[model samples]
Target: MSVNSRSDREREHFNALATDLGSVWWGSITKAGQLRLDERAKLAIRYGGLSPGKVVLEPGAGNAEFTKRLATSGATIVGVEISPNQVAIANERLIEFPKAKVVVGDINKLDFPDGTFDAIVGNAVLHHFDLITALPEMLRVLKPGGSFFFTEPNMLNPQIAVEKNIKFIGRALQNSPDETAFFRWQIDSILKRNGFSRIWVKPFDFLHPGVPDSLIPFFQKFSHFLSNIPVIKEIGGSLQIYAQR
Candidate 1:
């Protein structure tokens, strides 16, 4: 599909989610899901090198969950989302966060000038776009030495592989028409080719948000243990991407 059509489809899909499910479509409404968001937000803030005086760009800020959390660090955050409905929800979430705001825009055609941001952070957002085309825009917006952190689906994982490759499964899972998962090396190589340095893409996150609330802590510990193992670590459900420009 052409990029324009793909973006239109993304807008439609996410607008439906914003209208029908509000912020629950991506599984952040439950207790375990909330914990997962908290962990992802913490990782992004810590590893993305966000600070009080810095300016950060958060692309595809659906519902602004991460944007709200990022704002707590005192950094100025500009959140871009393609879906107007989703942007409305995101704006609601950031009502009290004067330092952050969500606007409807395309990541591939960002409106900012070069070297405008100190860092970029995203959560499961990059895979929705064509990485080869989108990474350059990300690189263009970052100041020298600026870094980025993103958590995306791991194509190596069994469920993610199936979800990405199988049409029926992906539709049932509410995936957008053009969204796909990525291998760690795929993203690492793309970042390298785009002139990013200090790149590190590691498979991580085994705890599913659907796990029972009572079992969440146990699974969290198990995930931590599994991360330390060699081969087993490669099959985690998501990839943690950290890189500098």
Candidate 2:
């Protein structure tokens, strides 16, 4: 097969995995894992400068889990997703939150007017996109003084490194060839190049998939402690990035 055909097929592979993502992905996470997700959303929303009545855009909003959490802050959120399947799921999940809505749309081709959003946020979605193309579009739609915040896998993590670099494991984890984890320097450079300022990149997350529920608090404390030490923190699970447009 030609290179382009292979690439297209791989793209389809990931998208197919995405359709059933919430059912398989979110449902399988442990309670500690769930709490960590909620914490990340809280931190991202705060750093993104979201406030009551402010408008925020969340791209790649699968199931609206993060979006629903952000809505707890009393902000108006629009979750844009490419899969109609996920959109429906997000809508259903967010039905009780009148302030949040999910719409079917591509992040690269956002239909909203320029400078229309107070902020843009996402969780585990940034790496699925080409920053070169997506960041500029995000900047265009964001109002001046608006912020962009999200959490992504830290490429420096040992387990993440193994998953991404190993072919069979990566595929099993549904990591397509097009997907990538982000390093702090890379995120810093991209945001700067895209005309963003006040960029903040923090690495956090210590609980693992295999850790027992009772040990989660102990692990969480240890993890946060490790993330504070220089060089050691690079191996933490996720990188939270906040930048002003």
Candidate 3:
């Protein structure tokens, strides 16, 4: 399928998912599913030096759960979501937050002005786009010295590749496409080309897919330990990157 058609289908899928969540507590249950994920995300943000009172933009703020958490830190939060239904649901979910806003738009053609935010953060969002277009756009909206934080599935990891291939093959058999692979070197080069410095990459979620939910906390601790080890850090299930523009 062409990128345009695939993007359209993805928008429809996201809309349906958002509507389903809206009908059932507007993502409260879905947010619960994100607890483990959020811990990882927060750890990345902390490592990236995210500060209170800064203006932050979250591109592809899927259920806006992370945006809500950022808002609670007294930061001004702006979330850009590709799905209109998701934007509406995020707005409703974050209504009580005085420092939060949501916009329905694509990150590749972000409508925000240059130097509009102090930091840009996204999780599990970039791999959805053609990276050549998306990475430059992300840099364009960031101010000089602004931080960029992103987390993506690490295709370089053996376990991640196996789990992802299983999902990809299943989707392909159903005539659906799953664009979730990563090119680690290409991503690093793109960040460098965009004039971002102080680049740091860290691996995460080493024990996620194979572990049971009840053991997530213990596994997360083990994953953190493994990520801190020299030889194994680059081979985890996810990669979290932080850079300064």
Clashing residue pairs in candidate 1, if any? none
Ranking by lDDT: 1, 2, 3
Q: Kindly list the per-residue Cα lDDT of model 2 for residues 49-152, writing each as its tens digit.
A: 77897999998786677788889888899988766666677788898999999898767668999999999998888887766677888999999999899988
**Model 3 residue 21 lDDT score:** 51
Superior candidate under lDDT, 2 versus 3:
2
Model 2, runs deviating above 4 Å: 1-15, 18-28
Report the C-alpha displacement of residue 239, candidate 2, in angstroms: 0.8
Ranking by TM-score: 1, 2, 3
lDDT of 1 by residue, 1-245 (tens): 67788888999999998888987255677777788778898999899888898999999998897789889888999999999998988898898989999999998799999999999998889999877668899999999999899999999999999989998999888888888988989888888888999999999888887899999989999998997789998999989999998
User: How displaced is residue 35 in candidate 1, in Å?
Assistant: 0.9
Put down candidate 3 lDDT per residue, 59-170, tens digits, no spaces: 8786676677767667788888778887887888898997888888876678878888888886666766766667777788888988888887788888557656787653
At residue 196, give the lDDT of candidate 1.
93
**Alpha-carbon shift of residue 98 in model 3 (angstroms):** 1.6
